[model samples]
Target: MELHIVIEGKKDLGGQLYRQLSDSIRSGRLADGQQLPPSRLLAEQLGLSRKTVSNVYTRLTQERLVLGQVGKGSFVSAPAEAKPRRQLAINLASAAIVAKWDSMHTPLRAPFPEERSRYEFVGGCVTPALFPIDEWRRCMLHGLRQDVKGSGMYRQAEGIAELRAAIAHHAAFARGVVCTANNVVVTNGAQQALDLLGRVLLEPGCVVAVEEPGYPAARMLFASQGARVVGIGIDQEGMLVEQIPQGTRLIYTTPAHQFPLGMQMSVARREALLARALAIGAIIIEDDYDSEFRYDGRPTDSLQSMDRHGVVAFVGSFSKVMLPELRLGYAVLPEAILNAALTVKHLNDWHTATASQHALAKFIADGYLSRHIRRCGATYATRRERLQTLFADVLSPWFELVPASAGFHLAALCKKPLDLDLLLRLARRADVGLHPLSNFYASTPPRAGLFLGYGGIETLDIEIALLRVRDILLQME
Candidate 1:
């Protein structure tokens, strides 16, 4: 690499070279073991004598900042203890808005490297063993070919035409969502869809209602946008529509299957939520995440399907069914919010990745998505059954399983008060990962319960993991 050195009126050329080289070395700009430009070449570039450059190298060598080799050029020496680079001092006055962001909590996060257990019952995670790798690889190849022949311009913010159409058709067929390509907006993930909707619909201090003991990420997201987020308590039906504040501009619900506590919202409550939204002129953001893996009962209509007055913005994600790393999801927006949402999406990230969109479009178009879902569903169903049996037979004394028709996870409310923290610790010690229901609640006092997700853990491993949990509870008793 060419070295940069300045000479002022040809005065103290060696000293100038030494200072700059020393600073670069000390600051880690010239990384350890990196070869410096030869003295002759550097002297020619800087319009200085080779003797001056060599003297500077010699000085650096004496300081132990440079290593001289017999045949090769000088290189930076590795220090025994690498010095940390100096950081700029923060001197500006703190902003109130930034302080608010700092105070916000992130409830849903991946465990650290050390925190990972052998049998993880973590929610929102999928089994890697069940993914259709061969089928997906073929689809990805098709996406690559399409990308190669593309216009090389930024695609539409609403999404590639094929994906939007595919999503519309899939949503209609599977979840009973009524929409066309024009209504769909493909996003990075369901999270981005929520963010775009929040940007379009929510103003600072606007009232937004989410379910108590609900998806914490959604609650924190709306709060980050300066919206006044309120937690409406949930029962067997879902979010209590009667308790929704009068001034609420937005109401977010996972009606297909409630988050953390898995329960499909009843038809009566769905109609009531729609009526409430219509009466208050509030928009409902129905997050239909992980609804494709329903194991029992007849399929129910989504909130978008039940919507009459264009009040629901139906959001869905492929993360639960497919790989979460895909970061692919879509929102079927009502006509009122569609254009504004598209515009916001354009401003957000230009658009979701085109290659993945093309791959998913092909995945759905060729029926691979449906086939994959069926295959994974069977595995998840078996796991869920194992968990149900364990809870019913071995662990019945400590917990009562919440009846849920869909989704990969189950919620078990405690029979009586117990040390949840201690149970989690003991489970971790036994190489089992356990999650509590307390993390989901916002305003209400959290009930003592556990969320046992069957998606990540193996079918056989679920029994062993729960058995260990039961043993821990026995010890506590």
Candidate 2:
């Protein structure tokens, strides 16, 4: 008959109260149809104002998480499933828990509240101000009309015919990838595309190579599949290909613009990587995630374009160029593995949303996609330049900026030893959304640094954000 709760004065008391109560109900600690203490009485028990307690109840009622009776107390609603029984003792041999699942470690992404910061520089995001909402809506409507007129059936596993063709054309012209509609497989997003490829390619105890200070999700995906993932180091040119350990079955690289570090793979390295893959009979995943917004010199030829031995499986996503929420991306496959990949794709998701694919096809074919890219490219270029200038003038003392040719983000290696954990704490206290470079590494000792993405942060606010960062760096000194 004892209730337990802690009131932390430093945090949002009301929100904490709401979340705790809701969790108690959902977890079955608060029984279904059980009456809660009166608002006045409970407020006194919790050392909160009566109004605060009442507001929590009102909000819960609006969410339909609880029900109130007239002249009675608030009660917990019945859950869709039976409530879990409280555990009495640990069962070491319990069959329910998978040992592998327990061993895996994945960090939750930190949420950045715009209201908390004068300027927030979170990465892997696009500027919302440039999204062509009106045009997108029109294209969406056209897709809807076309779908209604056609037979509604489960679509082919590869993708809708129109979309595949459009993607192939875009890849050939824009990325210099020699592919046809038959080689393309549409996916929910680049993440799902990676998943599908992993499913088809990786096996238990298989060896997979990924860049250290690389994309975590891809590494986790391979690890989850029971593949022994090796973290290969990266330099100014990109991942060290010769360093790939022998017997590696699959290689995943973000060559166009390496994730987190934001450096492009050099031409010689690309050629070397492709040749090595061929020599070892290993398949490579080339994720060209965000090369559509090049602000520098001539664009480097894609690894896929140089691929002759069918060693490269090229992945591209609309998340960067168009919008992340669109959940659209495609993979250009090698002929040998295309059928197997298609089967896995079918099993994984059946197919991506059909209407959206059709609409995106029309958008690309009608030249809207290209035009939007040109418009946004100009905006992103300005943001990139501003960030570069700030680092050169102010942040150069503590940080040596990475020379990135393309993508939404730029990273800097620390010139001096920095306490990254402490820096994160100080940055958070100052309302800045700064991330540590070490977070991207798995096995290798991570280099101390920061990745400042100018994508979501507006051009006007870039200077303000950098000044705050500079102030924080000064405090460390």
TM-scores of all models? 0.90, 0.80
How do the residues 1-477 of candidate 1 rate in per-residue lDDT, one tens digit apiece? 566666688687888888888877887777899998988999899998999889988988999999999898799995766565778877557677667777776757887979889999889899888898898999999998999999999999999999999999999999999999999999998999999989999999999999898999999999889899999988888889999999899999999899878788899999999999999999999999999989888888999998989999999999999998899999999999999998999988999888898999999999999998999989988988898899999999999999888889999999988999999998999999988999898898999998878888888888888889889999999
**Per-prediction count of colliding residue pairs?**
0, 0
Q: Lowest lDDT 10-mer window, candidate 2?
A: 107-116
Question: What Cα-based lDDT does every candidate model obtain?
Answer: 0.90, 0.86
Supply the global lDDT for candidate 2.
0.86
Candidate with maximal TM-score = 1
What is the per-residue lDDT of model 2 for residues 1-477, given as tens digits with 9 covering 90 to 100?
435666788567789889988787778888788888888888888888899989999988887778999987788785776376677866678544477667666542445454345566667778777988888888899889888987888889999999999999999888999999999999998988899888988889999999998998899999888899999999989899989988898999999889889888999999989989998889999998889889887899999999988999999999888888898999999998999999998888788888898899999999999999999889988998998898888988888888888887899888988887888778778777787787789998888898787778889888877788789878888
Query: What TM-score does structure 1 among the candidates reach?
Result: 0.90
